[model samples]
Target: MWNTRFRLIFISSSTYSALGLLPMRPCSSSDPKPGCCPPSPALKTGAWHSHCARSASPAELCRFRSLGPGTSGDTGSAAIESVQGAKNVDIIVLLPKGHCTKIQELQMTTVLRENVHVFGVEGNSDELDEPIKTVFADVAFVKKHNLMSLNSINWSRVLVQIAHHFFAYFRCAPSLDMHPLPPVEVVVPTGAAGNLAAGCIAQKMGLPIHLVVAVNSNDIIHRTVQWGDFSLSKAVKPTLASAMDIQVPYNMERIFWLLSGSDSQVIRALMEQFERTKSVSLPKELHSKLSEAVTSQSVSDEAITQTMGRCWQENQYLLCPHSAVAVSCHYQQVDRQQPSPPRCCLAPASAAKFPEAVRAARLTLDTPAEILALEHKEARCTPMRKGDDWTRMLRDTIEDLSQQWQRRFLNLPA
Candidate 1:
């Protein structure tokens, strides 16, 4: 049997490039080649359109462009990029708006202006929580929009754009800071978009991190990962884990792309098929590739509820419903006699965000009032719309801002 702990084998950028993975290279006077985009002929269907459909040769990918204030020599930018490329950069948390409650967390960290764009969406946690003005130059254009309306294509494009922009900001270099990079063992709490984004970003950056997509009872992602079939069943059943009550995960397009050996034509065809019939199965070879790096599991709403109370009772820590899903998955592994490496589950919200869910779980555990006081804390965020025509709006915003940023990026003062 394999050791219970996760043993990470780090691969150099040049080796990854040789293996047809990524074109990343260490920052130096030499050009840092970019990963290739498939030829236009290979992207004739599915979400491929506009700039994404065009072929980007290796040279074109290598061009260093600018979007804002940063040069390859910038210490802050170097710290950020090197952190991503380093073997020690382990678990990634796509923070749920206010991952950092205090402003002190921003010390010496490079916060991109585009991050504020993420906060502007109404009911977006970052709107109330993120220390925006302190980080970005402009937060005016970032507005609240319906998140549910984001379709596969829109999500794919947004994630790709964000990942590329973030990674390419500074040429890859060794960090000047003291933060040692940690190897990524598993990325937990698979809530569709975040998990897929983590996977896509890891692939793009050429990091060898296994993805663990933890899900609540809405188990499409779990099922897809386990069965190699991407499909939608009936409508998603609402539960205490409201944030993860999703039947169809749009970011699966990115996962499908990676699973299919980065063959644009194959991914385009699969996505088109899914759009039509609500199901698509990976080819045998592709399925094998996916199994190498990705695994998923489902935790029921009851398990989430129970886990929340158990955390409060046993560990004296309150867990939000979504976080409970991840905890439940971890324990489930133990129950099945399977070993899990050291893992970190992302907590998307404060326990106070879901007072009712917390109260219900804590009451069952008969917890004291003082600990549960987190429930009554004043929260400034509003409710997000369950559904809306948000796709076009987000696309427009990302495209316009990206264009402006690209110009700024290309015309940097050298």
Candidate 2:
């Protein structure tokens, strides 16, 4: 049986941070007080911030899974660390059992925190989102619990990510003195297409950027861009870049919405049709706009390993598998002698988090000692087996925690 604790907090809308509805506070023992952290420069401009948090109840609900090697670890660590020692804040994370690499799993499960609840489900990352969506669909339940997602599905995630494009452009741009800013090409290793959507939004907002969508064996995004085939593959092919091994790129809908001039009706119809049939051909106009806005390429497992090895040999920089996916596209363009703008390949994770990928690349593993220590730590997470009603399990867990919290609030015994 899993031992659970409900040390939780209710964050009001005005206090939500750019990362998600979850409020960000400075993490330090000395400053244990809870308050709104300073806003980023992007938020300071009053452009990307959304009021989605304001419409929700006070309790924060974050859904997390191992998207890739470093991504899940980073996300899980940040989520746990942010609410450390905070009262009335509980985070329930659902990760795909046996899908994530050992290091990735341990990075999340090893944290023996009372407020953090981690569950291992027998499914892929996309499948984990199903129960979360179902739970969030109950408006009354959501309000009663004050729930808000912290994943890429949240508008706040995309809004915060919009800053990445700006930062990359400013760093890569040659001069700001020109009549129009010089265009920079951003190669994003995409799975859920959140960052790619952010780049598109940035482009729409007059940023001079050419976005490149890069992917591994699971190449739905590549197919969507290269062809008008907005369809799922028969199955998701697991790759060294485990995060990009998603057949469904949900954020592509946002791109379509943006490119189609925000025609909500068309977007809604198309998405609904897709939800029903698991396939849809992009409209000619939308396809044309998508092609113009973004170019994409799909890398293979071989390519990922090759890029990782080549990067280590040439620059002594070991890239995580997901990063190598984007770098592979950069290498292809260079190899083909194609004329291109100043390029920045977004490397979202460290190689240290992907020892399996590093070993597969035939390179020496150079993981930090701290990361190595995770293997020895005691870890715990409830397993959601094949026959289990995951949604019911999730709801039961949330309900139990809420009841426990309520009881404690009223000075009742546990």
Candidate 3:
């Protein structure tokens, strides 16, 4: 039964991107090096600034912005680094931003270390935890801003837009090599942000992409998409996937807006009802639109553990609880579809981040001895409320980084 149930298939990008969906763009760069500028002096403390990469041809630079710093990590402000040995190509990563586990952080770090230049961006909930914020700040030059309204827009969705365009522009340039895989077609993200990101990417690329949203116990988004009842759960449950324990998915509004034929009145009515009664139901037509573009599935806490354990025992692969949820959902979808199309799952965390979950799954993470050797802060955090000035600070910081990158570009030896 286990063997029959598990259908592991890699979806080819060609089915989605190359065959008249969204064409893959070539990779080219004006700068041979794949790093942003080190740091700018004109940059004021706690301000946002733009950082960009230029094309080898006389094309405009590909740019994005980042915000000010938290208390810890690089300098007194957020910092981005272009690690050496990074790859030069286009990629789509569904980063949970604030919710990533150490394993995902390491993977991202490894990506940059491979010499692939990364332009960072900020997310709202990304301000939730220290580990995510610290790693993102230290690793990549970022662009950050508040959404149209915090209540409606999802941060991960916005970052995906930034990332998609960042690579799209990069590959479109005349001077670079081509991407091996075509543009991605189906993106399986663990939560609302990932789903929202997929939607944004599809909109930009002018392709009809299938968005598969994976959920833990907090199944509001799942139910909304599946049953047409977009109602809020009364309480939030704590699961192994702690970050995904949100009962209210802010980004669902965007999906509703897109699926409802971009009707502002419909969006306003839904939002008002949701705010008042904590529930909203989609009309059949709108539900049809959502059903056609997205698939939603929920995995139980027990199933998450089993998936994690099974992967470790059968494949020697370790997955954090959140990733386990995504994989489990993927398998379920595959079971039904049997030979499903090319799909990408966003595994934004590592097993090490949730050691207890790993142990519960009967697997052990081979954590590096040096990491275990380091002193760790007491596992405590106070809820930090975002300030109004965050956007301004982020903008100034991005500008500073942009200036520094420009200086580096000018000084490079021809």
Candidate 4:
């Protein structure tokens, strides 16, 4: 499932001002042409690639090595580019359901390339390896079709990608005074096991991290973390905070890698925590430090709605569903602590994405402009149950659309 704890930051902006908050890394300024800020060369893995409108059929166009990532970059981080001609490469996405309700499943099935293969992982509902098995079956189906998954299991990517940000965030902090920041604990609300996977990596790197979680009354984050397992609890639905709706821990392999260590090293260090005690499945006695664990404290949906209203009224900031929860936790944590560590709450999506929720919160509409545009009442999605499969829906739409693909590669070469 997801970790309720979050990465702490030291910034002076209000919740509405997340954009203005200092960035973790600045885009290299003044590049001659675009192709410069590339991902690691190793990522290419030596496959075909292009932006040309070659291969008229979706099936014929999926052999390329690189994928057209619909990377909705934060404001100035990376301009959205359209991958005009990149077609169906196999994809394994971990997300909640109902995320792509705005678009049809067939469209996603057909949009990329004929080889455009897609599999959705039910991370939001926290379904465990069942979703992974479903994805594997899809991969098997696609294998006969000449398409294969980039990452059928999410934990591998979690191990690698998560390492960068946790390290990068502390490195970028001008305030941390750079004390090797190991044992530098990070707590995120686990809606999916992704954040916890990241924390496990940071911990392995010798950083003392307290992986905290927050969930509504029926959430499974506590069950997963406490039992070291995943639960398919149908009772839990989306609360006011939509993103923290996951019930399965997708990246469990990574967690085991940390826990199965010879030392209870992780648990030994973290056992001092109150309601959430730590236990290192690792059995060795090598020098270790425990980053404590913090359990969740729920906020009323009324509180969240009101919090959104108050933030806009008091600070002129727009808080989407997920960010609002972070703000709530932040304010509470600040009041509880004598002095809070500089905290940074990562908003994975834009507030504009959820209009009904925003309207429900009674915030005035802002002009819609691409992702920047938030006023498309017609295109707005309504989740079936709260947090049902929203992320999957989102990943499906993001992967299947011709327009979204185009936006990802807008400035890049053919």
Candidate 2 C-alpha lDDT tens digits along 1-414: 111110111111111222211122322333222222221232312122223322324443232111111133344444544553446666677877777788777867887777668888888877887888788788898877756666677777788678777877776666789888877788888788988999999999999988888888888888989889989888878788886777777788999999999999999999999999999999999999999999999899999999888867755666788878887886786565555666666665557777889999999886789888998999988898888898899888888877777786777988
TM-score between model 3 and native: 0.54
Better of 2 and 4 by lDDT: 2
Question: What would the per-residue lDDT of candidate 4 be over residues 127-236, giving only the tens digit for each residue?
Answer: 42343345345654334333222231433335443654465356433345556652322335445455556665666666544455544444454554444323455445
Runs in model 3 lying further than 4 Å from the true structure? 1-187, 194-197, 200-204, 334-337, 377-414
Question: What lDDT score is found at residue 158 in candidate 4?
Answer: 50
For model 1, give the 10-residue run with minimal summed lDDT.
Answer: 10-19
Q: How many clashes in each structure?
A: 11, 7, 38, 81
Give the per-residue Cα lDDT of candidate 3 at 251.
64
Which candidate tops lDDT? Answer: 2
Q: Encode model 1's per-residue lDDT on 1-414: one tens digit a residue.
A: 222221111111100100111222221112211112211121211222213322346654433221111110111121233233222111111123222222111211223322222211233222211222222223343332111111222344345433422232222222324244323334355444544554556655665344677887778777777877777767656667665666656567776676666799988888788878987887878777666667777887788888877656644666667767766765555456554333334444335445567666754334446435434543232222325333344345444544554555577532
Candidate 3 lDDT trough over 10 residues, lowest sum: 11-20
* TM-score per candidate: 0.49, 0.83, 0.54, 0.55
Better of 3 and 4 by TM-score: 4
Could you tell me the C-alpha RMSD of candidate 4 in Å? Answer: 12.4
For model 3, how does the per-residue alpha-carbon lDDT over 11-81 read when each residue is reduced to its tens digit?
A: 11100111011222221222111111111122322122112111223332232222222211111111222
lDDT of 2 at 292: 98
Leading candidate by TM-score = 2
| Model 2 per-residue lDDT at 194 | 86
